[model samples]
Target: MAQQNGMVEKRGAGHWLTHAGLILGVLFIFFPIWLAFVASTVTQPEIARPPMPLLPGGHLWQNYSKALTSGINAPVALMLFNSAVMAIGIAVGKIAISLLSAFAIVYFRFPGRHLFFWLIFLTLMLPVEVRIVPTYEVAANFGMLNSYGGLILPLVASATATFLFRQFFMTVPDELAEAARVDGAQPMRFFVDILLPMSRTNIAALFVILFIYGWNQYLWPLLITTDPSMNTIVMGIKQMFPSGDDLADWPVIMATSILAMIPPVLVVIGMQKLFIRGLVESEK
Candidate 1:
């Protein structure tokens, strides 16, 4: 009886400690968001003062309205539209190209297949920042600058997406292809009918990830788009500050930051099940 009681006491103490650690972690992650939300609702003068208020303020509508309508360089609404287009374009373009490439690599036995696969794999090691100069020059020569095409196309070729699809395709049963061939199905027909449906989970997961990635793209958009009207909300937030010694609009900037996070958050929440399933299945 004494030993059992001692064990119970120890377990209780450990459980409380675990809960305390988890609560601290949650607060650490969420506190910044809470602070930004609070700032967004308060006046600039309130935020400018030291030890800023932690609670919500009364200026929510006013601050958001100002940020949406009278931005420093371009309207926040225009930037939001540009971000939506770019994010969707990147996600869709990457998924389409990755799916096709993966299907070809797995289904077809072309010359230089291994070489091509290795080349695509190599891109995983190289980031966009490393190739930005040459890529920008190519865009400039092609006259793609300041256009949606310029914003979307260059970032669409994702090595990670291609790799994920390739791994997933390899796991698909060879018997499916054989059966399709027996039924007089062309290669494209088999892919369209069979493999595409099999990859739905992966597609959803990649969509959520790629959408967030493209939505948050700052460098490429900033580099390619000289036109204010074509600015993305992620980069446009930086433009909210004046060029020189003027004080930045803390309230509007905070409000814009909150708005910028909404689409990605909704995407993740909406696709949570598929995303989790894909992550688990794709690893196998």
Candidate 2:
């Protein structure tokens, strides 16, 4: 009885430490965002003042106005549209293609199946950064530059997402699939009716993650789309810097940056449940 009580005490202490660590981690992650929010409302001078105002200032509207109209660059609204297109395109494309591919990998038996899996899996290691110049050259050579295709097409398939979905699919019991098969279900029917329905949480989670990945993209789109009209919110943020006669305003820049974060933030928040479900499923 005494030994069991000692064991219970040890478990209680462990749980406390784990919960405390998680709270600290959450605070650490949110601190930068809180700082950015405070900075977004203050003037440049106020930002660098000897005593910074930790509180938010009242310049939000004025700063946003400056950011919205400062250049040949697309307005924040237009930039949001571009980002939305890219995000939705990549999200839909990656999820659809990867889902079907992962399903095939787990459920279907075919020639070169393992080879095909490895070939796609290899792409995760060879990121776009490694092939940036080659990809750029191909885009330039084919005259696919400066278009939505240039921005979205290269990212339509994600090896990481494919692997993630594949791993998750492998966890689903073959008995469930064989049960479907016995019901005269076709391949498409089994996938859409049985598999995908069961995978709804994971799919929604991956969608949010992929959408955020597209929205936060900076370098590739910047390299490809030279046209000002096609600028994404990220590119527009870059355009808000100091020029020969233009002032470099911190509040405006921060306002734009914070505004740029809204959609992805909302997405992550809304899909928090799905995200947790994916993590739990992956672990299982």
Candidate 3:
């Protein structure tokens, strides 16, 4: 009895230590953003000046006004709209395509079906960076540049999500499918009635993941678009880092960065339940 109590005490101590480490790590990750938030309310010079201000300044409204309506070149409102249109469009396109692809792989077996599956799995090995040039040419060839379609086409499918659903589909009971077919139900009917309902947790989880991925897409967007008006908030932030000894307006830049971060943070927070449930369900 004493030995068991000692073991439990050891585990309790270990768990507390692990949790403490996690809390410290989270704080470290968020500190930079907190500093940026503080800096956003200061003069551009003061924002960039040495002996960095530990506390926020009084120029918040002043900076907010300018940052929101930056200038003739890069208005915050327009860039935010583009980011929204691109992010939502890509998320929807990606989810729809991934769902259909996953469904086809799970339900219908055609020639080279395994080959197609393996090819998608292979893409897991090669990230977007590897085939960037080819992807760029393909997009340019389609004349999709500077359009919402350009922003969305290349990212319309997600291998990770498809694989997630495929693995989940495998675990679904064959009995249910057989019963549905006996009841004169079609594949589409079974999918709509049984598969999709059970997969909601995983789907919601993937939605959050895909949304974040789309929201942070910068490289392809930058390469495909030369129009400043079409530039994402990230690209606008990049543009603020002027080359050749020019000083960056840190306050406005930091303010702009903070503004861009709000939506994704809200998304993750909003989807917390679905994310956790998906992770748990996938384990089963």
Candidate 4:
């Protein structure tokens, strides 16, 4: 009894320490965001002055409204819309293509199947940065510049997602495929009815990750979109900064930064449960 009680006491102490550490970590990460929110709500003088205020101010509506309607290059609302379209397009396109490619690789017995999978896998080494010059030329030839296709298409073929889906499909019992075949279901029907339902958590996980990836893209959008109307929120935020000796608009800039975070935050929060399950859960 004494030994077991000692073990319990040690575990209890460790548990408390873990909780305390987690709380501190949360505070550390959240403090900057809190400061940004406060800065967004206050006047420029408050932020520029020493020892910035910790509390939010009354200018929240004024700052955010100005940011939404009249940003430095383009309106925040328009940039947000452009970012949403790009993010959704990238996530959905990557998932769809990966699902089809992974499905064929796993379910079919075509010649060079392994070779094809390996080819796709090897492209992981050749990310967009590596091929940016040729990619830009191709997009230019296709007249995709300043378009959503240019923003999304060149970035959507995710080797990691393909590999993940292939691995998941492999784990699916062969018996299910056989059962569906015995029931006279076509390949498309089986995919739609059986595999898609099983892959919901995984799709949710990838959607959250890919959406953030797309939303945070800067270089690609900067390269492709010269028109201010096509600018994404990430680009808009950077553009909001003064180029020369001009005084920066701290409140509006901070407000734009806050607005930039909302969509990705909402996506992660909405899909938190499924994202966790997809990353950790093993069973189909």
Candidate 5:
């Protein structure tokens, strides 16, 4: 009885230690974001002074309003909208193209199919930076520059997504495909009715990742969008920095940073369940 009580005490102590460690880690990771939020709520002068206040100031509404209505270069509201459009376009376009390509690769057997799959896979080594010059040239020629198409089109062909979808599709039972064919379902009909439902969790997971990827894109948008109105929140934040001896607008910049985080945070929170399930749950 003493030994069992000792063991129970040991386990209880370990549990409390683990909780304490987790709380500390959370505070460590969250401190910077907390500082940013505090800064956003204060005035520029307050932020500029030494020993910045840890608590939020009374200027939350004012700073956020300023950021949303009239940012340094482009309005934050417009920038947020541009980012949303670009992110959604990239995520949806990548998923759609990847699904179709993977479906074709898995379901249809044409000549050099393996060769083609390998070719597509090999393009993963070539990121946007490697091909940026030519991609910019193409976009410029196609009149996609400074447009939503320019922001999304150059980056939408995701080899990673295609590879993931292809691997998933390969795991799907051939019996299902055979059953669909027996039912007189067309190729696309089988894809829409059968495959899409199975791939829902995966699609959710990829959407969260791809959406964040698109939202955080800075270089591509900077290269393509010369118009201030087309600037993403990332670009706007960078543009907010003072280039010369002038003081930076800490409050508004911090507010914009917080605003920039909201969409991705909302997406993750909203799709938390499906995202976790997609990553861990294996149908096969």
Candidate 6:
């Protein structure tokens, strides 16, 4: 009885320790956001003063309104719209291309199948930065610069999404395909009906991931979009800073930062169950 009680006490101690660690981690992660939120609510003068207050002030509406309507490079509203369009375009384009490519690799036994798969896989070895110069030149030559196509097309050529779908398709039961074949179903029909339904969870999860990836993109957007109207929120924030000899408006900047976090946070939160379900399904 005493031994059991000691074990129980030990478990209780460990549980509390785990909770304490989690709390510490949460605080650490949220501290910067909290500070930014606080700063967004305060006035510029208050922010310029050393050791800004921890609590929020009353300037929330004003700062956000100003940032939305009168951002330094362009209106934050316009930037937000551009970001949303780019993110959605990238996610959909990547998913569609990856799904088709993966399906071809898995379902159809074509000539040079292995060679083509290896070629696709080799793209993962190249970083975007390494290819950026040549990519930029290509975009310029193709008259894609300053266009939505330019913002998205170059970044869509990576193999990560293709690899993911290919691996998942491999794990699908071969018997399903056999059954479909016996039923006189065409390959495209089977893919559209059976495989697509099975992959819905994976698609959802990947959408969440790719959406955030596209939304947070900075370097590529910065390189491709010279027009103020085409700037994404991620890159536009830097443009908010004064070019020479003037101070940045901290309240507005912080407000924009907070605004920038909202969409991705909501996406992750809303799709968290689907994301977890997809992850588990994919692993199995």
Q: Model 5 RMSD to the real structure?
A: 3.1
- Stretches of candidate 4 off by over 4 Å are 1-21, 277-284
Task: Report, for every candidate in turn, its global Cα lDDT versus the true structure.
Answer: 0.89, 0.81, 0.80, 0.89, 0.90, 0.89
- In model 5, pairs of residues that clash are none
Single out the weakest 10-residue window by summed lDDT for candidate 1. 275-284
lDDT of 2 by residue, 1-284 (tens): 56667654646769789899999999999887877788887787897664768788888777777667663356666777889999999988988999999999888899999999989978877767778999999888888787888888888867877888888888998898888889878999988888888878778877777788899999888888888778888877887676777556668777778989999889877878876665555444
Task: Give the CA lDDT, 0 to 100, for residue 276 in model 2.
Answer: 67
Backbone clash pairs for candidate 3 read none
lDDT of 4 by residue, 194-253 (tens): 999999878988877888888999888988998999999988788878899987998999
Backbone clashes, each candidate: 0, 0, 0, 0, 0, 0
**Candidate that would win on lDDT:** 5
lDDT string for model 1 (1-284, tens) is 56767654556769789889999999999999999999999998998786889999999999999888877688788899999999999999999999999888888999999998999988877888999999999999999999999999999877788889888888888899999999999999999999999998789888877888899999999999999999999998888887899888999999999999899888778888866765565445
Ranking by TM-score: 1, 6, 5, 4, 3, 2
Mind giving the per-residue lDDT tens digits that candidate 6 earns over 36-87?
Answer: 9999999998988879999999999999999999887788999999999899
lDDT of 2: 0.81
Model 5 steric clash total = 0
Superposition TM-score, candidate 6 onto the true structure: 0.91
Better of 1 and 5 by TM-score: 1
CA RMSD per model (angstroms) = 3.1, 4.3, 3.5, 3.1, 3.1, 2.8
Model 5 ranges off by over 4 Å:
1-15, 277-284
